[model samples]
Target: MGLESAVSLYDQSTRGRAGERRAPGAGARPLRPHAAGDRSVGFAEVRDFHVEVARRADPALALVPLLVGGDPSKRGKVIAASADLRSRGLVPGMGMVEALDRAAEARWVPTDMRRAREQSGLLRAAVRREVGAVEIEGLAGFYLCAPADREEALAVARRLEARVAEQMGLPLRVGVAPARFAASLVAEDAGRSGARVVVAEDFEQYLLAQPIDRLPGAGPKTAARLAELGATDIPSLRRLGLDRLEVLLGNHGRSLWLLACGQDPKPLRVRRHPTTLSREESFAGDERDPGELGAVLVRLSERLEQALQRDGLRAGRIALRLTYADERTVTRSHSFDAPVSAVRELAVAARALLDRIDLGPDSVRRAGLVLRGLEISGAEDRQLDLF
Candidate 1:
């Protein structure tokens, strides 16, 4: 089968399984599963996806220090860099001028998104050929949920790594773990397209040995704050416990604490949208009124509905996030019984998620909505209603 057809087929099948495919009606609820640690989840991350594509186009650029972005004259940040360039302190988001200063002979090239997408689709197809359901993350990450036993997961990862090397001429670093977070972390080990199968029992120590800053969702800002608090590693954060961490960083800390102990239950979501869409509104001042936030949700949902309409897509899963006045953010998500594209349905889901949180007197400074698990509209009648 063609790459597009294979990816589209896997994408359609996963939409049903990832977010319960059911007619929207009474007693219908989307089931988000929490698999045990032994249920192998795989992470296949394409190493140097953009740079590798560029290298393939020009063979000589293989061993050279390369940066993907805009030319020196045109203003653009470094989007991706080769191992040699990154070793020289060139990171994504760095200015082109700074990069040039660091490496005078660096070959700066603009990333070809078209080629990236094409190569990514082929990689997804390769993984889907072995595993039934596949989730596309960004341009290079393909996650397979519950790919059977641990041995099967490892075998699939090895096969995928070799397949990409032979077929696409792109290297894919593979990791198999009991959960999504750990698997993704294991794949981050510095090297080209290596494979690491994290044992479920030994995962906690493996997780602790890694720096605290490596925790997913804990960005540079969060890491800096954690460092300031003297919790500079996973073990330190685990020592703080969930209740204390909650006091320190609000409810977001709860998830981080779980990561410290290797208990992250975050599921590997199916890529429902061609591109993940997020809409955020930051107030000039802290705003705590639920009614006011509900109004904002309506506007955001209207915007989300327009994007879905423009793309001829529907979102089966939605995530709600709020940043409080103290800068501590909390997020929650729900998968719908069926894909939703209407403003009213989106707003309803948004508010329902908002209601699940306790703001107390802490005013919310920001609110956002992220829609995922997109599928082509008119492909299936999810609900009995029409927009």
Candidate 2:
């Protein structure tokens, strides 16, 4: 029998790109390549390897992919309204004007990466609380221990699914496969389905047919380049010699080659606590009144204030989460010159943030608030006499 383990990778930055695109001048600095037989892989290859190794240890390895929180709209109103708008065909990244034009009643908004990260961290903690020791692949996804036996793995997957939903109020999908790549692929297919499993025999076949672009780590540019080279599918890419692949895609090419053939060598690392606290909510129905949504922001601001007070802290930075009913979420944040403790003050700042947001009623279903850059509050700071 192969190794009895599991692998999972949470796709990073799923909250459709909101920040300015990195300038070409801001490209990552080149790093030293691993010496042959170094037995060490770059950070980029770690998740793929973790899944592969876990699968080798356990044929029933489960692969779970988590969309970052707030990738969906952050406004409670928008998230609640998104399901209806989706049927009309709008999606994240659509221009506000275009989305509105496509569906007059559609609601749309930006995402909040900070709050999403916070919510994701909570989900990770919740998972860890239940499962004594599980591997967190990254910020948004993790792998739970699944046994080699089919029934047992499925049972574990079910439990994981329930815990995530209960704690985070977000749906999670789990896919089990004999190989890590297969499991990841299947998990993507099972998005929003909660849980799914694929056997070894079908795993390889499924992988072979998948577009190279669909593979983890193979982004749009890389996929387009591969297609240009007549390597449109995983099997075709796998058929190319390693040297040829390296020449075509550089180190990333070599990494992709290894992944294509299901030969990954990385380990899963545990997640750590973030430096901040945050929360997000989605509405159950579309709300046309911005006032109603503003009321939600008031509640969110109060919650953040209470949480900071409980921790004996004050926030120096704050962010807003806006979710369109179309499932698109956007986040914006700012740092103040001084720390703030009052919910009313935070709400004022949040309103300023909201003014910058253009998403309307039909598409908004969720909203989120994130507070960070905290500093310990002293008794003097809290006393009314200080003013």
Candidate 3:
């Protein structure tokens, strides 16, 4: 079968089973162990993650072309598409109307970000149990450093695939290489094989074999520009040399050349917890009374104070957001002289900011409170006077 057909076929097979046909591997050789302490960056991508999740949530979505994003009648882009559509170059961020034009019979659904976030957390937790630290690219892809021992790294990848499959019902494909970019490429090319590992020695040939689209950050525009330079694939593009590429594409050209040479010194960015906390509530009717809105702000501030105390954190800045009945939103903020964690301090600051915004003729529909610049509380001074 052709490469496109093979990829489309695998993309369509989202039931936790391997593709019936496998494409030729980029670098199919078995992985050999490197020197001890050599860090190997590995990337794991859940194949057809959005489609698979939607299917699991509602089995009725199976065996049909599916499009997940905004309402078709509204102005929005496509968030995810079926494998066959994607194989035909229907990617995320394309206009929904254009996407519908391509897949006329496809079913469209709104994005379920809340559910996607929950599933992503579960996926991360499963991988974290196998490997201590991981950097998630999005809801579906993850980057991690594996053991120096090639066999052990392969075992970790296998275990991760099995763990996610059993726990989250998602299939995982992994690729291990000396650097993050190459590893990502390897993982993409791994396809239905589950995992592909490339040692430093084979990095050059393996990278050379990849197509131009595999290069990170090189979108259709870059491809068109490269085509203008008579460079169609990785090898031809490399012939352009660093000087010519830099001259042609500027700093971005330099980055492309580095990846073309299998040199990606970038490090994994481990995921961190949220730095800001916010609470919001929508009013039932068009409530324009200042006293009523101020009361709501006070309640929200108290809730914020309780949350800060529970987390042992203090906020250095407070913000208020008001959503008008016409759907227009406005925000105002104030910074404190020092971090504050008490309900009195939060309410005082929130009320002061709320006073700054003019309600105008628009009736208020929602009020929100946000605490920013958070830091761990050092000690409690209940006796300190703010007045």
lDDT of 3 by residue, 1-387 (tens): 443553354345322345453222212232222222477889998877777788889889888898888777887888988888898888889988899898898888788765675566567667776775678787788888876457877898899899988987788999998778877888877884388888766666777788898788789988987887778998788766665565456678777877776766366786432377777767889889999988998888877776676556789899999999889999999999999889899888888888898888789999999999887676445435433
lDDT scores for all predictions? 0.76, 0.57, 0.76
lDDT of 2 by residue, 226-253 (tens): 7766788876786554555554456787
Q: Please estimate how well model 3 matches the true structure, expressed as its whole-model Cα lDDT.
A: 0.76
- Candidate 1 structure lDDT: 0.76
Candidate 1 RMSD to the real structure:
18.7
On the 0 to 100 scale, the lDDT of residue 137 in model 3 is 83
Kindly indicate the candidate among 1 and 3 with the higher TM-score.
3
Error of 3 at 378 (Å): 15
The sequence of per-residue lDDT tens digits that candidate 1 reaches over residues 150-186 is 5776777788778878877888888877767778877
TM-score of each model, paired residue for residue: 0.61, 0.47, 0.66
Residue 207, model 1: lDDT of: 74
Model 2 misses residue 198 by how many Å? 2.7
